[model samples]
Target: MAYIFLDESGHLYTQIIGEILEMYTPTTDLDFRVFCDQRHLKGITRAQFKEMLRTRLLPLLPKGAILQIEMIDSTTNANIQIADWITGALAKYLEKQKWGEEYYSILKNNIIGEGKELFKDYWVEAKTNKKLESK
Candidate 1:
């Protein structure tokens, strides 16, 4: 069993990445590349992020599947920039904005996976526990 310590984003990010990557598991010989937007990360160094991902990912990837992680600057990458726009549009759509609704309607059918809130109560429980500890 591997142990990984996560702070804030690492916890949720790990679960999300784990859920998505499980679909593309490669054997020990092939490399599976995961690209993440480094700008969105808070309170964690890139090294910590990599370690957090490795611990969770290594177990799932076996045989030919080598995990290759690239923490990229969203500003410089066109793909990442487009992704940021899509995310913004999705958020706006959720907020019931007209512009967002237009973009979202075009992309809605092409979206993949269930966007269920994983570990939804985790932050609430964590905050409550911290308050108890402080008192």
Candidate 2:
């Protein structure tokens, strides 16, 4: 899992969704299902949220690719709950909170990349991806 510093960003949903989606190759006839934890969105409607995802995702797909995105309450999903717990632990660890290292160490092996700042290399990388997609 990649650790992204998302603090006070209104576009947190996109970041989480995009990061997960970018992990896979967009192949023909691909059916990608992404489950996101529902949160109170400030400005956009739920429909707009889904559409925004499709806007970003569809460009990566070829002729025929199916993308399924669902926003569900975290309470109803055990997998989401585990993810939330892990996120919380990692956030605390990154923030250097009490017992952060101890908790982070438990799941250290699962972490892929650490210290990824959202504002720094993300946009550059996204542009690079777009360029790669065109070629």
Candidate 3:
């Protein structure tokens, strides 16, 4: 049995299943424009936008899901300027937003940091597999 921890940013979804992981970053502006146009927002607020994302995400997620969504306050930090630049570029190119600093921090601090031991274990396993293949 495998416990898959799923995460998403903008319209792109990432899935990490066992040792294999896949990420899809859409490459067309039309795709995002179509999505935005189809959403048919009647003056939708930011909160509504977030809620819509959560609702769409919920059904695709596994049962008893452990999901976290953090919104970074762009008004308070210099990092947000960098984030805005990234998002603006993405918006121009793909019509989507990238993960902001808060989410990035969560990944760096929580997932990656806590999973260091697991990463080390995988590193060892990978080395062992390579050695076996060479022998």
TM-score of each: 0.66, 0.70, 0.30
Across 1-135, the per-residue lDDT of candidate 3 in tens digits comes to 432323323222211211211111122222211122112223444455556555545454556554344345556556766657554653444323355444444444433222212344776798899999999
Query: lDDT tens string, model 1, 1-135?
Result: 433346666655665666666655545546778887775555567776778778767887765566788878889998988888888998788668879879889889889876656567887898899999999
Error of 2 at 62 (Å): 2.9
* Index of the highest-TM-score prediction: 2
- Cα deviation of 78, candidate 2, in Å: 0.5
Q: What clash count does candidate 3 reach?
A: 0
- C-alpha positional error of residue 101 in candidate 1 after TM-score superposition, expressed in Å: 1.3
Residue 14 Cα positional deviation in candidate 3, in Å, after optimal superposition: 18
Clashes of each: 10, 0, 0
Q: How accurate is candidate 2 locally (lDDT)?
A: 0.75
Where model 3 places Cα greater than 4 Å from the true spot, the runs are 1-42, 88-135
**Tens digit per residue, CA lDDT, model 2, 1-135:** 433345634357665667667656556657777787888765557677788778878888875777898988889999988889998998899779998998899989887885534556766798899999999
lDDT of each: 0.74, 0.75, 0.40
